[model samples]
Target chain A: MRAVFWKELADYFGSWRFIIIFAVICLAALSATYTAAQTIRGDIAQTPTEYVFLRLFTTSGETLPSFIFFLSFFGPLIGIIFGFDVINSERSRGTLSRVLSQPLFRDSVINGKFLAGLTAIAIMLASIILVVSGLGLRMIGVAPAPGEVARIGVFFLISLLYVGFWLGLGILFSVLFRRTITSVLAAIAIWISLALFISMFAGIAANWVAPVDQHSEAEAILEHERIYDSVMRISPTTLFGEATETVLNPGKRTLRGVVLVREVEGMIPGPLALGQSLMLVWPHLVALIALILICFAVSYVRFMREEIRAT
Target chain B: MAPPVVETIKLTKDYDGTRAVDSLDLRIEEGEIFGFLGPNGAGKTTTILMLLGLTEPTLGVAKVCGHDATREPLKVKRITGYLPENVGFYEDLTARENLRYITRLNRIPERQASGKIDEVLEIVGLSEVADREVGRFSRGMKRRLGMADVLVKDPRLVFLDEPTAGIDPDGASQILDFIVSMSKEKGITVLLSSHLLHQVQKICDRVGIIVKGCMVAEGPVERLGREVVGGGQNALEVQVTESSANLIESIESIPGVKAVECSGDMLSIRGDKDVRAEVSRAIFENGSLPLHIRAQDYTLEEIYLKYFREE
Candidate 1:
């Protein structure tokens, strides 16, 4: 298991494909940070300095999106790129049988490769976040409080889990499809549908499930929101977006649309504690985790029962 | 007598509604190169998979090195290695790096793995290019690298499925000679599966001819040849300058001579054994000078064709 893990890790880090993608991600992230630092500096008096460090991830400047936005959008691409060809390429290269013929259990192959991918994702995301935070601190000229640091750490963990879900999906496609191109296309197709089109799909489905107009009651609007959220959560991107939004912006307390003013009439108007923020996104975190496990488990079972051929 | 290194009892496999392998039984002893000869899709690979525990058999047991392949596959895998057809390596990695991964999978320590990698590379004549990426290697070079990979683990038994496939004739012969030498020097048992009869004919100690998943014949090359061509029958041809009146009678009277037919300048004799000397003497004794006498022997081609036609 260690052998496969180390080898895959080296492969991921050394391949030209991975290098190019890593460069794109870093450049985009740093650019997002540059813009975010500009916004924080331009309006220093208007914003509170309490969570100023966290603002670096959420604040979008004139030309670029926030760091968390790019991560939420590109995290699946990283996972899919790492996993889409993991098994099928081995099959095409006629190495599957050779590797399986060794003294390792069949599960070890999948386990090692998956763990290696996760490690690569973790390293990439961690370094990017750290670099962005350091740049943001340098630009904003404010040290982060311990609580703010903890929130950022949890946000990193949540992003890892979110990307892991996509990694598992990529592996699942690799196991299910024999051709590398086919698996890659399948992974990308799903990513496009979920990331770029799922919210649109959810809105349409929610409208059909619960119709609402200007004359509709507040109860009807709430029902429509409920359906939309449920449908949106079908995509890990939505869950990731909601989780990171709440974690990085601690003042946000809900994942649903505001249907009535009375809902927050008695609620506090300040950032919640770290535990409270975690509790708020607990379901999203659980859903993301469940997505990862389900994808991994399905691929695991399929690979274990798969008939390996040297084609 | 030594215990059999590999044994399969009534091993069968079915895919969907069709049976790929029937209730086939096979036994191979230590230090023997057993040729699994068959046409395309004759279940040669399927049987190998079952023996390696890469795929489970629908019925029956495959035991390798005294371990049930299905029940205790890791143990079987530990003592055996497999060189798949068109064997592959990580194209972007050096030969040593690719092999290091295998050694790691086998749980060999780094220092030992490095030594073993060097030793196997030396054996395969890849030491000069050990650090060169495998993507730049020729097909024959990759096949040799595959051999080095199989040997790095020091397995007791090796299953080579069409190891010489897609290589030039010179390279194929070199690989065959290498296999012979490896077995002779290391005493490692080999189960070689190939549809190319002549490629394996010279190196295999014994051969099993499978047709439509059934074992049609199993034994040494000459034995199978004799069995398939009819019970030990031999064909002999003789040329004489002149015909003698009683030469035909004399040749027919020779012991073990089944029949004799005389042409203008040639005599065709059929017998249970070599009767060339006796027939030549008979011709000379009868005043008919004999010029040339030759015996016709069976090759693997004839034997494979005969069985394949029967099936």
Candidate 2:
């Protein structure tokens, strides 16, 4: 397993695809950061600390501070590219048959690829985080508080897991599609529709789908809206973005003004509490892990049972 | 009385509704260079894939070095090294890196790997190009590197699918020579598959001719040649001074003459037994001056064409 892992890791760095991905992610994050910095200099300079935090969490601009939003939207795209051709390329090149003829088990090949991709993502994320954080500190002219540092660490972890979800999805598509181009195109289509288009149309979809007649009871209307939001959040990217926002800012209570209000008269939970935020997103986390495992399981079984001679 | 290095008992493989390999019964002896000769889609690759555990047989069993290929693929893989048609390596890495990676995956002892890598590189004539990136190498160079990778593990049995395909004649001859020497000097069993009849004929002691997923004929190259070209009997070509129609009739009427064809004054005769002396005596007795009489042996090309054209 270690041998396979090391070779895959070397392959990732040795290939031009990895370099291109790293450059794209870095350039995108830096562009977002620059825009955010310009906006911070222009508006609400004397706002209170809570209001400043809220603005940082809610707004998307061109400064390093706004990179979290760009990353959440763009990171999954990178993850998909990383894995969409992993197995298919090997098969096309005729290397899969040769590799399988060795003493290593098939499961190790899948596991090693996953670990290598994950490691590459971690490296990319860490470098982006380091560069952005350094620029942010320089611009703010103040060292980050320990709480702020902790929030950033949590955000990094969330991004890693978010990328993991997409990596698994791409690998599943790779196994299911015989052609590498088809697998990559399929992944891109899913990304464009779910990541970019779904959220943009969520409100309109909700409005069109929901019954807005005045005769309808408020409870019924609220129930209808809840279903719409749940369905939209089914996309792991959307769920992870919303969760990251809640974790990083800590005070934002609702995402897009669609909140699941649970009436609890006995005790009022603190809105900015980290533990509360984690609990709220626990289901998304579970779903992400489940999706990753399912994709991996499917890829493993298919590759093991697949006729290598077919390619 | 050593066990067969590889054996298949009525092995079969079906793809979708079509049978790719139908009840293939094969036994390859240890240290023998066996040729699997067939045209495209003749199940030669399929059979090799099944033996290497890259594909599952639909029915019956295949064993490599006494290990059941389906149920115990790892054991089979451990003893077999396979080079697929159009074999590919990590082009971005150096040839040495590619061999090193395969060697590691095959779990060659760490201490012995460096020496084995060097030895295999030298064996494949890639020692001078070891440090060059595989992407920059020519196709023939890449193929040699691939062979080195296969041999790095020192496997007992090797499956080579069109190992010399696409190579220059000089490179192909070098590879064939190496294959023959490996089997003879190291006692390695080799199963080489090829659509090119002459390539296999040059190196293999025994050849199995397959057509449309069926083994039509199999035997030592000389024996197969004899069987297909009429049992080792030579064909005699005679250019007589006089009109040869009478000579041809006389030759056909002579004992042991199988067939006779006459073109102008030239007569060609095929016989089941050596009849050169008898033909000369008959020609002399018929009062015809024999201008030229030459005996010719049947080439493998003739035998291959004869058998392949049968169905």
Candidate 3:
């Protein structure tokens, strides 16, 4: 298994696929950093701050999206490309049977691949985090507080899990389909539904479950929106989106329906502590982890049951 | 007495409704080049998969090197190497890199594996292209690499499924010679599968012909020919320009030659020894002026057609 891991890791790094995908990721990170840094600098000019590092990751200027926003949008592709051809391509190349004949357990192939993918994700994500932090320090002229640093670290881990869920899904498709193109297309199709269209689907389901009646009062509408939001969180894409928002943007007090209190109307706004932010998004984190596990489990079983000889 | 390298008892497999391998009872002796002969889709690959423990049989069991293939596949796999038909490598990695991955899976210590990798590559005559990416390799080169891949583990038994399927004749012969030498030098048993008759006849010490998942015949080439066609008899065809009714008596009178008969302008001689030169000399000296003399040896193809045509 260690052999498979090392070889797969080398293949991932040495291929043109990794070079192209890494280039896209770094460009996205740098552009997001530049835009967020511009906004944070303006904010600093208006009011000096200790959590400028966190603000740089969350803030988006008029012309560019934040780092979290870009990652939430394009991160799945990285995972998809990494895993879309992991198994089917082996079958096509006729290496699957030969590899299985080695002195290794059947599960070792999948285990090694998944571990290699996670390792690559960790390294890529860490590099992006460090690079963006550097840009923030140079642009904002302020270091992050210890609590804010902790929040960023959590944000990085959640991003890894979020991307890992897609990696597992891609591998599942690769095992399910005999053709590499079919697996890649399947991954892209699923990505489209979950990343781009799941909220629309959830809205449709929510409307079907509890329609607002149009003539209903604001209270009924609030109840309708509550179901819609929770329903949208069923998609891992949505879960990761909300989780990162809650972690990266400490000012995000809640993801649920908010109720205004007249007694605290004049109270000043302040960023939530790291622990509070974590508590708020704990469910999303768990859901992402569960998604990763379920995808890996199903793919592993399917692969083990499959006959290695190509028909 | 040492156990057979492979023993299968009533082994069967079904994909959906169609049985691929049905009640196959087989024994492959230790250190012999055993040929598993069958036409396309004749369950040769399915049997190989079962023996390697890459796929489970629907019924019965396969034991390889004393390990139950289904119950202890990892143990069987540890001692077996398989070169699948059209075996593939990581097209992007160098030949040495590809072998390195296999060594790692076998858990050969780094110091040992690196040296073993070079040794096997040299054995396969791939040492010159060790640093070249496999994508640029020819079909024949890839097959050689597959040989190197399987041999890197120093397995006690190697299963090569159509190793020369698409290779040129020279490459095919080279591989055939390599297989013969490996078994001769290291006493490594080989179970080679191919539909080609003459190829298997050249190197296989024993052969099993499978048709529609049934073992139709099994033994040495000569034994199978004798059992299926005639006992201790081979035919020679003599085409003469002049009809010679008296030539039959003259041919039979030669020692170890019998069953001489004349059909039209051709004389058929069935004999134990290949006395084509003497028969030609006899016909020439007898004034028949032999136009063409051909040996009618019963090859695996003729034997295969005789049995396969039955079902």
Candidate 4:
């Protein structure tokens, strides 16, 4: 297990593909950091210590999105890239059979690769967060509060799970498709669908479930929005976006997203307490992890049963 | 007196509706080179996979080194190395790194693994290029590295599937010699599958010829030839530079002699029993120099063809 982990990790770090991915992710993170810092430092209102740290992740200028937004958008690329080729390439190269023949459990090959990819992503996320923290410290001219640090930590975990969900899906595709190129194309297609097209489906489903008739009452319109959000919540992209927004934006009191004035009346203006925010996003976090686990379980079954020959 | 190193009891594996590997019963003793010969789709590879427990058998069981392959695959894997046909390694990694990864996968400590890696690389004559990335390697070098990968564990038995399939003659002969020494010197049991019949005939102490998922014949190469060659007759092909009228008549005088047919410079001497010695002596006595006198042991191809035809 350690062997496969270290080897795969090393391969990930050394390949030109790694260089390409690292460049894209770093550039995105850097741009997001710049825009976020500018938005926070330029704010005229007197911000609290806990809220100031939160602002660094959630603040966005007119032309740029926040750090969490960028992460939720691009993080799947990391996962999709990690998973799309891991098994099929090894199989194609004939290394999978050789590795399996060694003294180890059959699951070790897939397990090790999964663990290795996860570790690499975790390390990368940690590094990026640290970089942003440094940037935050420099731009905001103050150390973040302990509670804020805890929130960021939780956010990181959620992001990792979100990325892991796609990584698992990528591996599933790799196992299902015989060709590496085909798996890659499939992963990209899934990413695009989840990010852009799934919301459209959710919108359609909301209308179908609670059709917005021409003379629909205000309550009917409110119901349509609620149904749309519920449908959208089924997507990992939506879960990730909603989870990060709730974690980083303490002002976000609910993910049910009450639009009616009556439901918003009791909401506090301050950022939700760390515990409260965690409670709100726990289901989404669990769902993201469950999706990852399901993908991995399916991949294991297909890989174990597939004939280990050069056919 | 020792139990067979590999024992398959009515092992069967079916894919969808077709039986890829039918009920095959085989026993191979320790330290013997067992050649598995079959045509394409003849179940040689499928049987190997099942024996290694990379793929489970549909019925019965395979035991390698006294461990049930299906139930205790990890135990079987620990003692065996597999060199898949057209072996592949992580192309971005050096040969040494590839072997090191296997050592890690096998969970050998670095202290012992480093020494073992060097030893295997030396054995495969890959020490000079051990630090070169595998992608840059020629097909022959990659095959040698594949051997090194297998040997890192110092396994008691190695399964090599077409170890010399696409290599040049020199490289193929080198691998053949390595297989011979791996068995003769190290006392390692080798279960090698190959389409190169002559090479298999040259090195294997025993061989099993499978035709369409069934074992049609199994024995030493010479014995197999003797059994499969038609009419239980031994033939001698003698080429004489100078024609002598008395040569054929003298050879025909021997007991068990069937006929002596001459075509140009070649004399085909047939007998119900071994008579090559008597025939060679007859040629010299008749004052015609026998430029080439050789017993017609059917080539492995001929024997394979004969068995395939019967099937």
Candidate 5:
């Protein structure tokens, strides 16, 4: 296992694809930071100083840490591209057969590749966070509190796990498709449909499918609203981003016009509590982890059982 | 006694209801270069994959170095090195880097890995090209590098699938010579598959001809040649000064004459027994002089053609 891991790590560094991916992610993050800072400086110059960082962190509640959102969107894309050709490329090159003929176990090959991809994602995310944090401190003229730093760290973990989800998906596609192009296309299609398009459409579809009938009953409308929110948050990226926003800024209100009014005579717990927000996103995390495990399992079984004769 | 390097009993592999390999019973003795010859799509690559445990057989069992390939793939893989047709390396990595990756994957001692990488580069005559990326290598250079990767591990059994395919004639000959020398000098059991009949005839101690997924014939090259060409008898072409038609009739009537044909002043005769003495005497008696008589032995090309014709 260690042997396989070491070799895979060496391959990641030895290949130009890895270096290219790193450069692309870093450049994307830097560009996003620069664009956001310039846009806010010109448009929101009259706003209070405290709201500057808020705008940078949450732009219209749609993007989180503008840089983090950019990284999250591209992080999984890089993971998919990095791993979609992992097994198929080796098989095409005939190296898979050669490597399997060695003392190494088949599981070691898949595990090694997965770990290497995870490591690449880890490094990329770490570098992006470091760059974002440094830029934030320089621009804001103040470092984030320890709690904020800790939350961002958790956010990084969530991003890594999200990328891992796509990496496994790519590996599974690699096992199922013989051509590298086909595997990569399948991965990208899934990413675009599920990660980007599906959630957007699901919300609109849910609204159309279950319209709020205000004349019927107030409780019925509330139930319809909850269903819409749940369906919209089905995408793991959306859920994770929203959870990060809520965790980083505890005083934010929801789009549904629910505000935390501390002056109320008797206050009931709102939905913005950290633990409650985590619980709301917990299912997405579980589902992503499950999807990753299932992909890995399928890939492992297919590689072990599938015939490897060259065409 | 130690087990045979590779053994298969009634091994069979079926793909989509068609038998790709059927009841292949084979034993490759330790330290011998066993050549597998066949026409295109003869299941040679499929059989090699099964031997490496990269593919599962539909029936029966295959054992490599005394370990059952299906049940104990890791054990079987531990002692085998496989080189596939159209061998591919990680093109982005330098030749030395590729070697280092494979060496580590095979669990070579870290201290010895650098030395082994250099040793294999030297063996394949790629020492000068060690630092060059594989993407720049010619087809023959890639094959040599692939062979070097297999050699680095010191495996007990090496499965080389068309090791010379796509290589230049010179490089092909060098690879063939290298395979032979490795088996002879290092006692490595080599199972070589090739569509090139003559190269196999030159290096292989024993040959198996597979046609349409069935073993059509297998034996020593001399024996196969004899069997295909009718019991080692030579075909003779004799030129006579006189067009003695009676001499042809007389030679055709010889006791051991298998065939006799005459065109112009030449007569071609094939016979299991030497008919030279009787033909010369008949020509003399018919008042004709024998100008020349040349005996020709069967070549591997003839044997290969004869067997594949049955397909």
Candidate 6:
């Protein structure tokens, strides 16, 4: 497995495919961070001073979304790009049988690939985070508080899990399909539906489940929001979006329907502490982890049982 | 005698209700190059996969070096190497890097692996191109790399599935020579699967013919030829300058002639023994001139065709 892992890692870093995809991701991420930093600089006086650095990630400018939004939307693309050809290319190259014929267990092939992909994602994410932070520091002359730094760290981890889920899905497709084109097409289709078009789908589904009108009462409105939120959560994109929102913007109290005033009469109005914020998104984190494991497990089983033909 | 290097009893595999490999009983002794001869989809590759433990057998068992292929696959794989049909490498990495990965997977120490990689590359005549990215390599070069890949681990048994399928005659011969030398010098047991009959006959100590998931014949090439076409049988063709009833009759009357066929000025005689001497003398006795006389030997191609035609 170590052999496969190290080889795959070198291939990923050395290939033009990795360089191009990573460049696109970094350019988009930096631009979003630059725009957010500018927006934060202009409004520093009105924003909470302690969480000013956190706002560098959440504030959107006139033309671009926040840094977190860009990541949530593009993280899946990175994962899919890295994983969509993992097995099928080897199959087409006729190397899978050769590698499997060596002195290692069959599971080692899939396990090694998944671990290598995760490591690459970690490296990519870390670099982007470091560069973005550096840019933010230069533009906005405020260092992040310790609590804010911790939240950012947690956010990085969740993003990794989110991308890892997509990587697993890509590998699953690669294992199930014989041709690289077919596997890549399948993965991209799923990515389009879940990452790009899922919100549109969720809106339609949610409206059908809990319809509302202009004159609808507060109860109907709350029901509609509840249905919409749940439906959106079905996509890892939404899970990642909500999770990072809670971690990066400490003031986000809940991802649920609007609470009644009576229930919040004595509750604190300030941002939740890092631990409390984590508690709020715990379920989201679990769901992302579960998604990653499920994809890996299914792909592993299918690959282990697959008949590898030399041709 | 010592245990066979590869043993299979009643091994079988079914894909989607169609049996790809039927119950096959095969035993290959150490230091022998066993040719697995079959046409496309004749269960040759399927058998290799099952023996390598890449796929499970529907019935019976395969044992490699006394280890159960399905239950103790790692052990079986540890002692065996496979050069898959149309073998592939990481096109972006240098040849040495690709081999380095395999050595790591086999868990060879770094110092030893480097030496082994260089040694194998030299054996395959790829030392000069070791630093070249595999994407720039030709088909023949990739095939040679495949050979080096299998040899890097110094496996006790190697499975080569059509190692020279699409290479030029020169390259194919070179690969065949490599296989022969590896067996002779290293005492490595080889199970070579290919549809190319003459090539298999040239290097194999024994050959097995399979048709539609069943083993049709298995033995030394000469023995199989004798079994299929009959021992001591001769097929002789004689060409004459002039044809007449007298000449035909005289040739037919020759001792050992079983059947006589005449087309144009040629007579094809089937005999239980060589009668070229008597036939030539009789032609002269009949006052006819003999132009040419030739005897055809039954080769693996003929044996393979006989099996398929019978089926």
- List runs of model 1 lying over 4 Å from the truth: B240-243, B273-277, B288-292
Which tens-of-lDDT digit does each residue in A12-75 have in candidate 2?
8877888998888888776666565556556656644542432333356643546777787787
lDDT of 6 by residue, B1-311 (tens): 66789899999888889998899999999999999999999999889888888888999999998889899988988889988887878777799988987888889999999999999999999999999999999999999999999999999999999888999999999999999999999999999999999888999999999988999899999778866875557888889888888888877777889888999998888888888899989889888889999886678988988888898
Give lDDT for model 1.
0.89
Model 6 global lDDT (CA atoms, 0 to 1): 0.88
State each model's CA lDDT, in order.
0.89, 0.80, 0.86, 0.85, 0.78, 0.88
lDDT of 3 by residue, B169-222 (tens): 999999999999999998999999999889989999999999888888899988
Lowest summed-lDDT stretch of 10 residues in model 1 chain A? A255-264
Candidate 6 wrongly placed segments (more than 4 Å): A214-217, B231-297
**Model 2: per-residue Cα lDDT at residue A182:** 96
Number of the top-ranking candidate, with DockQ as the measure:
1
* Model 5 DockQ vs. reference: 0.55
RMSD of each: 1.9, 3.9, 3.6, 2.7, 4.4, 3.9
Alpha carbon lDDT at B36, candidate 3: 94
Mind sharing the TM-score for model 4?
0.92
List ranges where model 5 is wrong by over 4 Å. A10-56, A59-65, A213-216, A252-265, A268-280, B231-296
Which pairs clash (backbone N, Cα, C closer than 3 Å) in model 1? none
lDDT of 6 by residue, A1-311 (tens): 77778877877888787889789889988999899988887877787687888887888999999888888878888898889999888888777777777788767888889899989889999999989888898989889889988998999999999999999999999999988889888988988888768778778977898889999888888888888888888999989998999999888998875787877899878989999999999999999999988997898788877777767
TM-score of chain A of each: 0.98, 0.87, 0.93, 0.94, 0.82, 0.96
Better of 1 and 5 by DockQ: 1
Give the TM-score between model 6's chain B and the true chain B.
0.86
lDDT string, candidate 1, A32-147, tens digits: 99999999899998888789899889989999998888988899899999999999999998888889998887788888999999999999989988888888888888889998
Candidate 4: Cα lDDT at B171? 95
Q: What fraction of the correct interface contacts does each predicted structure contain?
A: 0.91, 0.78, 0.83, 0.84, 0.78, 0.88
Model 2 lDDT, residue B125, Cα = 85
